[model samples]
Target: MDEGPQFSLEDDGAGGNRLVLSGRYLVSTLGRTNQQLRAIDAPVSAVDLAGVTAIDTVGAWVASTLAQRHGAEITGAKERSLRLLEAVKIRESSGSVAPDRLPVWQRVPDHVGAMMRDLLRGMAGVVGFLGQIILAIGSVIRHPSRFRGRALVRQMELVGVSALPIVGLMSFLIGIVIAQQGAVQLAQFGAETLTVNLVGRITLRELGVLMTAIMVAGRSGSAFAAQIGTMKLTEEVDAMRTIGISPVEALVLPRILASVLMMPLLGAYAAVVAIIGGAVIGEVALGIPFLNFLERIKDVVPIHDLWVGMIKAPVFGLIIGLAGCYQGMQVEGDSEQVGKRTTQAVVSAIFMVIVIDAFFAVFFTEIGWS
Candidate 1:
């Protein structure tokens, strides 16, 4: 008769991984059961399975269980050992388990709808802002004395002072680009000298003023929105009303009146810089004499073009200021909300300015005044 498979554990010394298992395993000869598993006494990197000979079904099950509980790094585990482990669902103790299924693609529509909802919320804020402007206008009309001269002047400075550098830079670069493009196309027709005409006419009539307004819309419009939105978020608007002060008189009025007054001046400033820039490019790239460039430019660009551009300035200022103030009133009392509305203010202001420019184009075209 053979003894059942089992083994006694060894004493693990210091500095080794030790494993202790109960019971003996494997039948070697009659009258004595052979050792099946040897207990690891030290830190073991591997277990020797060579000691395992003919394994009963229980022996296979024991091997598989040990492999799963510890590690299956046995040096002598052959196909039989692996097969037995597989049949019993034995796996490495450190093996990673992952989900059997992946998430569905239906999350896409939900994300898109969220984005659209945010856009609509921003638009509603703009509508509320327009209503506030009307209310402010009425209040201002009813109380003209409320217009503090010193504060109004400061407001004008806010709208105009910081705008000059950007206006000059953009207009100068735009003039250079126009001159370069004009020279290229005109050279094909042997009329490269006409770059003076192209630069002067385009800059004075449309580019200079439109570009100035757009810049202001981007810069000042966003400032207005962020400022107002932050105040709204902080409940400053409500505090003013509580103190018997009108937010319009205190905030919207000054900014709007400033924009209405100063953006035209700034536009005029931009136009002068643009013309000067065009003249510089006209002299170099187009090889046109400065004196001739100026003289010829006078004949090409009508003085009325300057007026047309200047007229668009106050309108742009209104759109920009209104958009900013409107967004401010819509602020949801968070930094993120303020930032979002500020961006909306800038985009809407720029969009409105472009729309107004289209109207100018039509008005000029219909009146037979290029």
Candidate 2:
């Protein structure tokens, strides 16, 4: 039977100590020996390993550490044990465990440069993705048979029809808040009735479409990323390609088309619902007749305001759809990536929507749309 590792120290004839090790020095036998070794701090001039019947890398490391601490020479170690000891020594000398630190000024510039590089790469990727979508749209146009009408209809239901209740509820509450607040502010100026104009114009020109876009980005946009990301993870996208189907046309085009087509309608519906909500507040809180408020919307809110919202709606939808599908297609490696990409899609879509809305606001103001 193999014995557990044991160690002892004895004085050399020259008045120095020699540490002697015995028994099997394998990892399985080193538990008590390790504890015992940690407790010893005696000066030693040499380590003798001849009495060890079996040894491994762990044992070699322990012996090497003990010898180095006391500047002791190792003796009676076989060739295999010597090699392990040398390997551990070399690794300890190499600075692989910790990285070198840079000055704060250097690190700050490096971080900023990296961020800029990432931003440029992301912009290039988005441009390339847009080109792919354009090509896919053209292909569907050239070969009408490739168009998946049922898929488009289904996506439309998911992106638009199914979203109505929540969108309506949200827009209604926003409208009430806007009206109540506007009424109070205008009352200070003795122009309380102008709340009707405030609610109509703002909801039609900005809040209605912007809020709806945000909701859709949170809802359908995230869904698109998750669904396609899951499909990618499952290799379903690859299977479609192997069978001669363009994943872009079969998967992406329908979704984009559905969003582009449905957004104007949804935006218009949300605006109408918001106006109705404002009308409710007007009647109950401001003592304005509901019918008169509705009649006033037609006159107080310009036709151009509705046109501005309608114009932005499809663009917002396109942005949301593109962001979602692009992030989904970018998913790779593991299931964890699907969740991360889904979150990225929602964030990117809403960010781009707000950016584009700002640009449109400036452009329309310059062109006298305001």
Candidate 3:
């Protein structure tokens, strides 16, 4: 039968004692070894491991802890035992280490720097994505047979035909509100009749296309982002790429083309709806006859105004489609990212739509379209 692990102390004659260990040092003998170590009252000068015939990690931990607590040197350890003791010592030291704390003032600058880097990286991604879409467009132009007509028709129905009811209702309400407000203000100058001019010019030149674009951004734009992002999360996008299909051409181009083709029609329909709403409001509030209001619109609202809005509609559609699809392509990791990118797509598309409208307003004014 093997003897259990044991420990003893030796008086070194220099006012310090040496700890001596023997027997198999393992979990089975840990209690006995611990009791023996705790009974020693003298300050330990060193731990003598020469008599330790067998050992393991648990035993090494016990020896290392005692050596550290007493500030005693480890002595007489064989090469293998020495390595194990060193490992235990390192582990103990690492466990005792504390993380450095930063002051609030220092942390602010670090956070800001990280934000700036992230913003720059995001901008670069957008630019690269734009280039990819342009290349895909070029490829489609070169290979017209590769175009997906069914997908394009489906997207047109989604982006245009299905959205008509809400777009029409929204535009109608907006026009009524605009006419009411214009009537109230123009009545002060006995120019309540000019409300017809106000409604016609604004609806045909700006509000019709602008409002429709915003609606599409919120509806179709978010849908595109969520749909593509979900596909990405499920690795469907990756599968398309692996099978040698260009996701940009097959997935993105149809959406963009559909939006571009359908936007002018939607905007035209919205404009007519808004004019009808304005006419109703004018007849009820200002006692203006509907035929007289129609005559005023025909006489005052120019063809240029309608053309200006029509041109901006397709451009706004392109922006909405690109923004939605681009943000979708950026989705990574998980479902949370899909939701976040979808929100970003809607916000970015609306923002770009307004900014582009502002630029158009400025350009048209410079060229005397105003």
Candidate 4:
């Protein structure tokens, strides 16, 4: 049943437009009206939305769009509608955007108050992260048996063994791509022999870790989100709490520990496979001999490059693990929410990896050679 006040319009015409509209919006009502509006082919001026008993975002959108197309004056658009209209008005006034289309600070809320709020939020997050880490460490200490040989073996397999195939494949492809691209540029200078150094250095410090992290984040992040979300939906988290088992300690800690421990090893493996792939390409395509490639690699790849890659590896792993866990925890009992959170986990993990990689690049540049 259509449940609200049915809207009708009254015209008060005296050389001016006066439109009165009243309606109670339901799905069927709005749908039919929206379709009617689309089919309309006449001047619709001075809309009176004041008669709307209860308006929602969709109704507002429809009304606004109608106003735009017909040059009609509309009233009673609310909240989001008001902001959207204001933005549209701004755009309309500036037909061609000026050089300073928006002020520098306008892009993001740059008022002092907003800046202070953002700064406070950032600091709070940092504090919370540190506190969590400390608490985790204390819990580990209380149960030092968790660091047993068997536990280590399990984690090694979980992190290192599982990550191999994907990392190997992606790294090999990346090596080939970098080599091929660099060869095109280097060939002009007749520097075909430099492919080894180019591939080695780039793979070791940048592509190897970055590519591996992205793959793991996509693979593992989704896994964590799905696993945790399903658990949450099934009330497994509540069960764990009832059993006095800290879910964080039981699940998250192991995964984090495993990743942190194995990322360096996986990264090293990626770099090696990538180099082999690049070496194969350089030898066959670039006519550089195997021994010459090895010699070039030895000359250019310092221990520092390997160290940088190894250092970033743990950070990358932590980024993937934390993002997944965070998004998973955000999931409600709703089944759709699980999928949504899983996607967020993968996205946030990848974005964080890229941002961290950029920071590492800057750091490496600043530090220079060992």
Report RMSD for candidate 3.
7.3
**Runs in model 4 with CA error above 4 Å?**
1-130, 146-155
Off by over 4 Å in 3: 1-111
Tens digits of per-residue lDDT for model 4, 324-355: 77667667858999999899889988998999
- Rank the candidate models, highest lDDT first: 2, 3, 4, 1
The list of candidate 1 runs beyond 4 A from truth reads 1-127
Displacement of residue 85 (Cα, Å) in model 3 is 21
> 226-265 in candidate 1: lDDT tens per residue?
8888888788889999999888778888888888888788
- The better-scoring model by TM-score among 2 and 4 is 2
Assess the local accuracy of residue 79 in candidate 2 as a C-alpha lDDT between 0 and 100: 84
Rank list by TM-score: 2, 3, 1, 4
Clashing pairs in 2: none
Write down the lDDT that model 3 would get.
0.90
Model 3 lDDT-worst window of ten? 89-98
* Model 1 residue 362 CA deviation in Å: 2.5
